[model samples]
Target: MSRNAKINTLLLVLVAALAVLPLAFGLGDHKEEPFTGADAEAETAITEIDPDYEPWFSPLYEPPSGEIESALFALQAAVGAGVLTYYFGLRRGRRQGEARALARLRAEADADAGDEAASERRRV
Candidate 1:
């Protein structure tokens, strides 16, 4: 396999290991609600520290249920990923096109120079 393929395979394995190791070892078993978001944990800590604490602002829109909230978050993440991917893909394509155009121009210039040199020799 090529060097890039080998590196990609290794990265994929490392990512998979990172995701699986925590669950396999039951890392959050001590928690009442394992795998809860950091937001919830922060809220719990704040409430524990100060019972009278109140939020200065509220969310503009709250999902009716946890499932909906999760779905919305996933949707947001997917859209963001898509935007980034599109941007990078466009940049790569433009760069490749510019390189090809430059190569073509260089080849044409060399061919023109060769032809001019040959004609001058023939005239002499």
Candidate 2:
């Protein structure tokens, strides 16, 4: 109904389309392992280019299975999202509080000025 609501709805639709279009169209069907991570793709490319290539260092801690690795990645993403959400929410609350305080101060000042004017007229 409102302008902001319309905009937000449009944005949500666009995000959903972006997420769904690839899967709906089978974009990764050509790949042997579709939806693999960039790291795995990079490793495949490197090995293809140079058979003797070796990594400078291995991961300090590797997950026991792909499922565990994906779970850990999701957990990391969720934590990062939570931190960002908290930070932004705090900033917005502070800004709204400051704005309300400023409005209250202005209203008080205006009321004081009106009282002063009325008192001056009464005295005269």
TM per candidate comes to 0.69, 0.68
lDDT of 2 by residue, 3-46 (tens): 99999999999999999999999999998988888987888999
Query: In order, what lDDT does every prediction score?
Result: 0.96, 0.96
As a whole number from 0 to 100, the lDDT of residue 122 in candidate 2 is 100
Error of 2 at 69 (Å): 1.9
Model 1 residue runs over 4 Å out of place are 1-16, 49-58, 117-124
Count backbone overlaps in model 1: 0
RMSD of each candidate relative to the true structure:
3.2, 3.1
By summed lDDT, which 10 consecutive residues of candidate 1 come out lowest? 31-40
5-124 per-residue lDDT for model 1 (tens digits): 999999999999999999999998998988888998999999999989999999998999989988999999999999999999999999999999999999999999999999999999
Candidate 2 segments exceeding 4 Å error: 1-12, 52-57, 117-124
